[model samples]
Target: MNETRQPAHHRGRGPGRLIALVLALFVMLGLSGGTAFAAPDDAEKPPRAVWVPDSAKDLVAAMQPSWNLGNTLDAIPDEGSWGNGQTTKATFEKVAADGFRSVRIPVTWSDHQSATAPYTIDATYMARVKQIVDWALDSGLYVVLNVHHDSWMWVEKITSDHDNVMARFNSTWSQISTTFRDAPRTLVFEGINEPSFANATEAQKFQYLRELQTSFHRLVRTSGGMNANRLLSLTTPAGAPEPAFMNDLYTTIAGLNDSQLVAQVHFYSWYPFSVNVAGGTLYDAVAQKHLDDTFANIRTTFVARGIPVYIGEYGLLDYPNHFHPSRVERGEALKYYEHLNHTARATGVTTALWDPFSYLNRETLQWRDQALFDWIKSSWTTRSGTASFDKVFVPKSAPVTAKSLTLNLNGTSFRGVWQGGTKLVAGRDYTVSGTRLAFTANALTRLVGNRAYGVNATLQARFNSGLPWNIDIVTNDAPVLSNATGTSTAFAVPTQYRGNNLATMHATYADGTNAGPTDWTPYQEFNKAFSPDYASGAITLTPDFLASLREGVTATLVFHFYSGQTVTYKVTKSGTAVTGTLA
Candidate 1:
């Protein structure tokens, strides 16, 4: 399905919805007399009954690959307020067509409902939610709808406001159950997204979850219609995949004795690698083990006990942080996704991508990176060969020499390398020894002809099976940085990358102590303390980094590059101003 293309067209636009808009406007403008007005009680049509009752295991299996509609309905205050486009049937249609079997619509209801007794959710918002769910169901995709941001918003207040919190939680689920009471079983209801209670101790955290999830279970069961047996998912505190949190969820599901229940958890890989801190720039052993162990534990804890687990959300923590540079490298991210999906399939765990238009563009309905998506889609059923890095850097100032890259066969055999339609000769142009793939100097010289400052050629390493690995031939030298003077809040050093890419930055004071906000590690987090603007030929030292420095102290900044080069520079903080000197 990812291979096909279709012309974009709007579909299933809700008719006569301007009245709902008028109601919302009145509420926003304080014209509703301080009480939110409910929409007309128009009898809603029931969804077409196409789902047959199935075991929780079977249901989760059918949801092999799922996608989340993140930052949209889940956005605080209101939908589309977080930069995502309005929800439409075409969104789900594209998802279903592109190989995602299910969709997770995270809805935040804090601002949409009343704060007092009955906790009345505005009828207009409820109907809009139903419209989106029905459209996904009609597109033949399973829908996992959940109480989204309300988790931290109000649900977490249970520690301080227990009575009122439970009241609102019960009322919210009661309305949700009644609305989808007759919908097909494909519509799964998740109680809460990442539930956590403030000021609660370890014992209280577990106790609070049991009470909250039990209430949700009871409310959905008594709502009648198909709701009596609808597949319900319960989550631990923060939806953490840790053993303690998962064990709590398992105990709760077992205590309920309902075969239609699912254990939900969210994973963002390892913290250091996830946020690209502490020199975790690569998906190394620690990061891979975190992913493997977490998934393996999920299998042993839930799947082994005849209980299904749904990884409600999984992705890098800083994935598609549109405002900053990528924390993880492109090839490294591909490896993470491939390993995650393959591991999920192996352990019978269902995973849903936590997408906030990070992978697919909501506006155009196209993948932001088709090749990256291809590796992900391929891993759903098979393995793809990858390498240590995606780029083959050749120094432009020197003669082209042979370059070797370690291959991550990923259980696949390497065939050869291809440049456009021409395949390089196995022995003459390139050679493979064990996992090492080396490009001969002759091959490098020919490929990097008239070497530019950026990528000069692209090569694809074809494997015996699955998708091919991409290798970019880039030309560059050690990046150059110039002295600069500016205030602590706005210091930008003139830089000329010369085609080389920054990997990490080390900051240390004259006394040899670590510098910057992250004092524990000399290597500062990418895009946090500092960021490189390759196109603009400037390196910006963020205010947070500068603010952490001591006045009159000179900190030596070492810029590490993926090309195995480092540029040293020194900066001294003088009260509110700072000066950078090229070392």
Candidate 2:
């Protein structure tokens, strides 16, 4: 992620000399414990003082579903330097048309500034940035402009060049705040992007980062214009979303007592799903837990405390990797985006997608992943149905074999159909009336045990609009023991099982008496009786399950996999040990 490069024009200088020169320049500019700037005359007052929203919640609410003009203006030295094309007025128009409420423009001013004292930002670069900002505002989109990826100055050890770094940071913001001082409330200023501290303890890093943010807050507030009331954003050290990092930031910045401030954090939860294509499952229990835990912490730690948080960057990148045969599955990507945005809205944390010309095709003004794009756009306007199976168990020999499924439509009525594979066989195997799906007894009996079965459907209301409304009614036939050993039982099924799969165990004695269909207590559940190896996509009975076995007893373990596929494995105990084979 490093893009550091010194200006070719500057000659070699010792580190000590450079530090002294930067410090001397800072003193000259009155930044070293002196008056930072001269008071502006009455004639220079801002034309109009925009009333910045006083509530952080309101500010975050207004910036929902934001986008980043990443790898563009934030590129070093010049726009388009990083392979991303130049920005245009039409790009902002498309972003608004695509349903983004706000835009974040990341600008790296280091390469565009004079390296010596009182580092001045280049006029041309400043004009270009202003142009983009104006375009977004004109298109009725909230805009956030921030210093980004200026690694040369802040990425080094703070102990070595703390003063020089401070000088550059203060001078840069003084210029930026002054330039946009008269801008409307729609324009927000972010202090920095992902500040890094080298060779420092967590405590030291927190203190230093807080000092930097303090400088930012002070500069923007006292820059002599409408900036005093403008909304300002500050990020924690490293821009991490961990609870500890957020708590530290909250503790440090709460001292400022500024209600107009918005807390910023970046989230890329579950790297295998978000970035690389390895070592993580999508939309599963584990992934959901991470999301829930992170957001819940932020909500309790910040949002509930009246501090609005914004996800400055979040979204999976479309990169090729060996684990996934292709780019992220469209359905999985849609689920990811929908869940994240939905949770954010519920938690009062605004979200912005980080795009580098992957999902959104900027050149053609179309989304490369249209399904993902549509899901995001429609979620803000549409109502959908939730489907679940009441009973996933399918007994191969019993006449009482029907799966009762229900779909609640939130009181909206719609025409529906049941589909399986490539055929539309609603009346053949199942019937869908209103929100109820009733599978035929014969169809349920024919379901292959130890395998996955799915009933797919779609619903379209007369008044509804947007992406196709569909659901997958999936359940497993009772798991049959696929293999057995002296002390172990194994069942094979699809790997997409939910947490509720293994909740019971039953035993049928050789004397025609039933021992139990024991309810696996949540605290001591059968799911906990086995260990899963995701890489192998299988679960093996643990010694805990083995300990429960008794000679001359046949046991059945019931569980469910993805789409409600239930499995029932039969095991025979011999000599105080259990052995099993597919039934």
Candidate 3:
């Protein structure tokens, strides 16, 4: 670990840094001066600051469903919403109607931040954001406020000593954190957007990220915000949650200062694999498997180690070019989304669909094409029927299980048990013959109409390790797991930055045994490569974004690795498998 390990004491912790330093001090002084790295005792589960229901559940239970927000609940809209602007409420309603518990509003803060470098959002603009917040809360949905596109701004300034960016970022949050200061525990505040540009090392980028996150906590606490225990969401270099991204997040903020934080990833892929663009054909199960495995691989790399992951943005293609489902697209996407939904549930990850208005093209707000609405519809069942007359929204007698989240099932007038049968257990069939039931946790879900929430027991486990041996460098060699003689070095992969599966860079001896570093052998990373996304002058492209398009025509790419191996292929039929590195 050439990375200098200086006394384990973080310098300049920003806001949360001081808290972390104090906690560290307590460990050094209180633990009999043992000098062992220490962490603060977990306080009694603090008040939750974010909980929300899906919009689908809301449609079934809205007081006034007349006003519809467009594809993005991000309209710099006017009244009837938050920013003095209109909203994408119709979209949010979809979230509420489903059995979701929260609404993640990805705001492009640049709209407000574009001004004199150090941005200041006016009352009119903020009112629009708050109005939407009110809508979600009023609908009993947990509201999550996060800066989305502005990650670009921070990146632009980070290198050139752009102090204004930092100032604006902090100042913006000061007011925001303070305004929602009295908000219920259901409201959440994420530090930044999908923070990164085309080129930024994972380590360096995350260092800045830590500074930003620590700032959020500092401002919130110092500002005496209401949602103090706010559930914070951390950013990866990009939306990819690869090992490098995860490690950076962990090292930078994990022990910095304690706050409710969740790791987040955006599930956007370009293969027969990514659900982002839904029209691709998955004719080859192997190709489909390869695609799906990508996400599974990512989830396991981070989540398996005990960090909760939230798939903040995932959706089948329902936009400009890919909106309409064809004979090919529908057949593929219909089952694809179902499988995606099932997979998400099985793993207990939370999901929020992108562009609610675009779920089924805006012209026809009703889901006119595709089977997303159907799949979601099947998973939910009405929980009640009575209006204000009933006084009680849902029956207190109803059962809520880890497998099933409460929802307004089907188009039923009243709420009823929507059997949590989406993901059948490994050996069990999701059948109803005599009443025995089976289910798996949905990767994606939300809470029902507004209700106070209790936090889930965090399923987390960290892997601390000892040093090992090193092995020979296999240049241009595709790792073959079948061999029992070569090394399977652990190269910590990069998340959204580029697509190399990151792992701990470890080396084993030629004898297929654990031969870690000892001066005899050294460790290294076998950097994977995909075709260049683009290049102009002295610049080169990386494999972070798999599918690249130019002039509306998507081209093929070959991924080359720093390890000297390269995989080449082209795009045919959304996800048709082409030849490349899988040699």
Candidate 4:
């Protein structure tokens, strides 16, 4: 063989039995006399479980709240590389504030190569990467560490031919897996970047995945790094991880079982304005539902197996970068978020908005987009509603009017509210396409544990009769205000606090269901805080901070504070179908 293959002593080291099957099968299969012995067939194999990732899903979500970070990282220098360490720290804070819980730092050590095969990554780069990671890890988020563009070796022809590509892929990951052997647990690693196998046959791709899957496991185990059994995330060819096109990848991928790598899928699905169709964007029911249905089942598929997930890359076109009609692009993004939020919750896989800074139009941050800083700081909150409705709501504004929608609480059957124009029903299901209001019939009552387990947290699980819910919350004509610095001129929570204010109140009900006010508080508590900050324009607080002050078992509290004369309710979640208020 013209290509030099590394020695075999560097294989996996663990108590698990070596695969007698793999070896026996290979031997029985009979190798051609000319077959290369040094580079075994398992060269490009990924680990047993390629679910764990070395990128921060949290940081990626945070940085480009409106764009995808992994793709973005491919284009620019990381924050610390351009300025003092403070810039990197500040960037982390901004990302965390944006609700990101991890970051994937792409390292191309080859850039730092100093005329050598065992290229050394610069200490400066490592320090900078570490600085941002420390911020993310400290902020209670996940982090991903991987060798990135530097894996270009896998891109060129294997020995300028077919055989060598296999050899290099394994050698590269082996070296990579070894290099980060001592990184922290939170830092996951990825094996490759978006790779293209243009010349490889479909059969070869199948064989390649299986071989790479097995080898990835071996390399991580051998690198003797934290990567062993660590969460790893793999990518689909060219970042197009559509299930329909890559279903076989899953069938073959299931064989490697290290239990760390989570299932991963990328998406950029479009219609009407892409490929064959020539028209305005399709942010309508067709596009939204397609995305909803596709991802919903994918999550269900992985959840059954107990694997976690990450959206490695996904977003609308980023400015000068064209996907379609520039006019309707923002709306295109809004529909995407709605579907992602509603569908991804059960899988515990949120989103990492893709925005390669220089690649996007900054103004994409219009309206109530959580993707932009101003929107997040201003009106992009978890909720908004009427002040009048704020003071105790009991099924007032609209009535249930859909067909067959179910209302369940805990584990019992109860009547849910539905509305068509203005009517309510008790035992029927109503479906409203535009705007409908609903309240779950039963609230999750606090749980009681076995006497053996004293002082346990309340059990808050909902075991409904497995029915579908289809009700839309009315968007109040009057703007909803939860804090002083609201984006719109109309809706702003007045704040007047002398140190004591709850930010959120988790309220459960008699029927084993739940609902909470984004800024819940006792009337007086609300007044005390709201009076001063009414004119200031912002209020922020943590859920635990709210839990600290309690009035009674069934009361709601808002955990909020005034800093520099401004109330900050930094974190929030919103619902599109909230009724007046829970009884």
Winning model by TM-score = 1
lDDT of 4 by residue, 395-425 (tens): 2123322212222232333333323333343
| Alpha carbon deviation, residue 485, candidate 1 (Å) | 0.8
Tens-place lDDT digits, model 1, residues 199-312: 999789999999999999999999999888789999988999889988888889999999899899999998888877788888999999999999889988999999988899
Model 1, runs deviating above 4 Å: 1-53
Backbone Cα, N, C clashes tallied per candidate: 0, 14, 95, 98
Please give each candidate's TM-score: 0.91, 0.62, 0.50, 0.47
- Model 2 / residue 197 / CA error / Å: 1.3
The deviation in Å at residue 455 for candidate 2 is: 16
Runs in model 2 lying further than 4 Å from the true structure: 1-54, 151-156, 276-278, 319-327, 381-415, 418-427, 431-583
Q: RMSD to native for every prediction?
A: 9.0, 15.1, 22.2, 20.4
- What are the lDDT figures for the candidates, one per model? 0.85, 0.63, 0.42, 0.38
Model 1, 46: alpha-carbon shift in Å? 16
lDDT of 4: 0.38
Q: Order the candidate numbers by lDDT, best to worst.
A: 1, 2, 3, 4
Report how far off residue 505 is in candidate 4 (Å): 50
lDDT by residue (1-583, candidate 3, tens digit) is: 2222121122122343454455457566764222211222223211111212122122212111112233343443323343223455454445444344456776665555446644667777677778777666544455568776566755446655557666877887887886778775556677776777445566567667777777876787676645555566776767765657766776655575553566667664443323221212232355456447756765665456555556666654333223221212332343344445556655545665665454444433356444445444332221111110100111112343223112111122221122232322333312222222222223112322222222212111111221110111111123221101111221112112121211112223334432222223222211211111112111111222222212223233233332333442232213322122111
| Span of ten consecutive residues with least summed lDDT in model 2 | 1-10
**Top model by lDDT, which number?**
1
Q: 189, model 1: CA deviation in Å?
A: 0.6
